[model samples]
Target: MDIHALKRQGMTISEIARRTGHDRKTVRRYLNGDRVPGVRKRAEPDPFDAFVDYVTARLNEDPHLWVVTLLDELEPLGYAGSYQSLTRQIRLRGLRPACTACAHVTQRPNAIIEHPPGEETQFDWLELPDAPTGWGFPTKRAYLLVGSLAHSGVWRGVLSPSMDVPHLLAAMTTLLALLGGVTRVWRFDRMATVLNPVTRDLTPMFAGFAKHHGVQPVVCRPRSGNRKGVVEKNNHTAAQRWWRALPDGLTLEQAQASVDAFARRQDERPRRTETGNTTAKAMFAAERLRPLPPVVFPVVVAEERTATRQALIDWRGNRYSVPPELAAAKVVVQQRLGADTIDIATTSGTVVARHRVVEPGLGVTIRDTGHVAALEAIAMASAPPGRPHRRKERIPPGPAALRAAQVLTGTGQPVSTVISLAAYEQAAKNRNTLR
Candidate 1:
């Protein structure tokens, strides 16, 4: 630039080179705009270029593959480079193919949405696949129904055993309570339990549930999930931070408590806004969410449990008593939302037992007096009805065994059995004498 400026003042190239401490040829290159100031040709051939074809080919095979995983593969193939350098080269060259299916999920053009207080809450089910086997549900897939207050970004999650409609309702009720209240509008992503994605209409069951709860349901556009970005952002945070390194030995209820605690602790995190920085707890307190109804929407949330040998069925880490006769039988355990008691019924829907609810994961065993009495009577009834069987009675084999003896003796008839009374008579005499 100095050389060009000097030339613009009519200084010769030789004079400009002398003034700028550069040779005339170098100064001429700058004056002619042929040399960029910071760019220079590499003295050595690029080592990264040797692996470009391999990286591009692997990425073409799976565009969503992680760079770390690619590096692992690259190392064994003799590509010596830092992960940062490989990623930078791939990014600069646009080697990673654009995924048509994932374009909606990846970043793209979008407008920011401003939510009013108490206006909306978004709900989503984060599916945690291959969950710990000890979680005790039938399948390896576990679900968490998350609810986020759009305006305040306050979120709560309910760890559910399944993602079916009944569990969805149960979890949603619990999540709403954790959130303190219900927003006027509920946003969803066409969850099959709540909305029929084919018809784009509310399912009959969820429609009734929403009407009962007095909240309007809004399904996002077909591919525009960012409309409810609050919950989506939370889903990522939870999956990465909470579920990734989840502590072992946590039952479903224990994990529920853990995740709830995780959500609560996030309230202390600082959030920036146009006005000033604030915490979610502060904004959440200001939200004017409507009070939840006195009773939750009516839904039968049932789980199938097998009764133990003691005529008790396990539910939420607590055992509830059933009839002794139903021992080792599969029974239906149903608990209504906001109900104080849980009902244990036969597979045929006969109410066999009901137990007062207890806090979950307490390892408590609940047994009704009647059930205990019946179980005790059953145990006694199984005892010998008459006199207890004599351990050492003076008796001989009669029908079957004597018949076998007679046949062995070639008599072909029943044999008479002998009774020894001498020992008994002596014992009786001794007892009388002592008295």
Candidate 2:
């Protein structure tokens, strides 16, 4: 009879173990409702044992008798069990609500692949706001060119101007120097500067840069980011790591140094993807940096000059005081913008004094050394001989036409153009007057 009762409940040995607080092995020995010594034979006495008859009688009457109402009624009758205990007993009584089981479980499949050493690296450009370097003129926030290796997880980055041609060249040169050499193949997005816009081809600009550095440039397909997925992922990762290292209100150079140090540390980290491996190990063993050039880059200087009495005579924003012999003549002004250097020349190409452009509008006037020497020679030669007398003044034009002529001369355009513009202006003014 007990076996029949247990079988009707569908109580498995494991469930018996959990419910009765006995080991599964012990419950299994008592399986098939076999009674074992020292083990309770039947259902344990419930604390609500005394109320069971009354509760069962009410449930039989309605089958839907609320557990809470049943507990409330039993309370006055000296019932001591809590609501939870009565609920568990109700579940054991086979009156618990049934729920539909889920049809299937959904899960995401792993998509990561392992790469060998010296395989590939992802490249990207990250722009930051201009920074305050201690230089007198504010050096603006620039870009940091970044590259990350797929196998080793090593990262390289360098600061540069906008990701234009010149800046890109400088950045590539800097990165090659940092990494000890270039990689076999570099993967990056199809940036317009590097790829041909019309054809969507990566064969031209990248080819040139790659040839120079002895590496291959491979661009990710348009709208397909996962082709260069490693670098795209690393780009975000490196940004997070490097952004925090940027100095607050600091110079670009300072922020760059901070990023470099952080990158070095990141490279030293043991790879989470590869068990017991680090970036430094793979890069040092498999990667090699390009050799440095014998000579460093040259520094260019700039200058500013203003036009002179000799219409063309100017140097670095200063008027070259040409001799009276050449006054009202045209010459040439040459200046170097990178440094404080300037040169002046005649229309015939005679070289003049090369001097630095000075600050202030007119305070520090530069007297051309050659012009001064010519003046001194003239004065000395004239001091010994008697000077010529002054000539008489000429007659002026009549006032009636002179005033109108003065207005016409001050108009500056060719007289015909000025007359035409004035006529148009007067006609417009007359129409307004009519209105």
Score each candidate by Cα lDDT: 0.88, 0.62
Query: What's the count of clashing pairs in each model shown?
Result: 0, 24
Clashing pairs in 1: none
For this target, which candidate reaches the highest lDDT against the unseen true structure?
1
Off by over 4 Å in 2: 1-111, 130-141, 203-205, 273-284, 288-435
Candidate 1 Cα errors over 4 Å, as ranges: 1-107, 130-135, 373-435
| Per-residue lDDT of candidate 1, residues 149-268 (tens digit) | 998899999988888899998899889889988889999997798888788789998999899889899998877787998999999999999999788888778888899999999888
Worst 10 residues of 1 by lDDT: 103-112
- Per-residue error (Å), model 2, residue 140: 6.3
Per-residue lDDT for 17-80 in model 2, tens only?
A: 6777778776666564466566575567656668778877777666656899888999999988
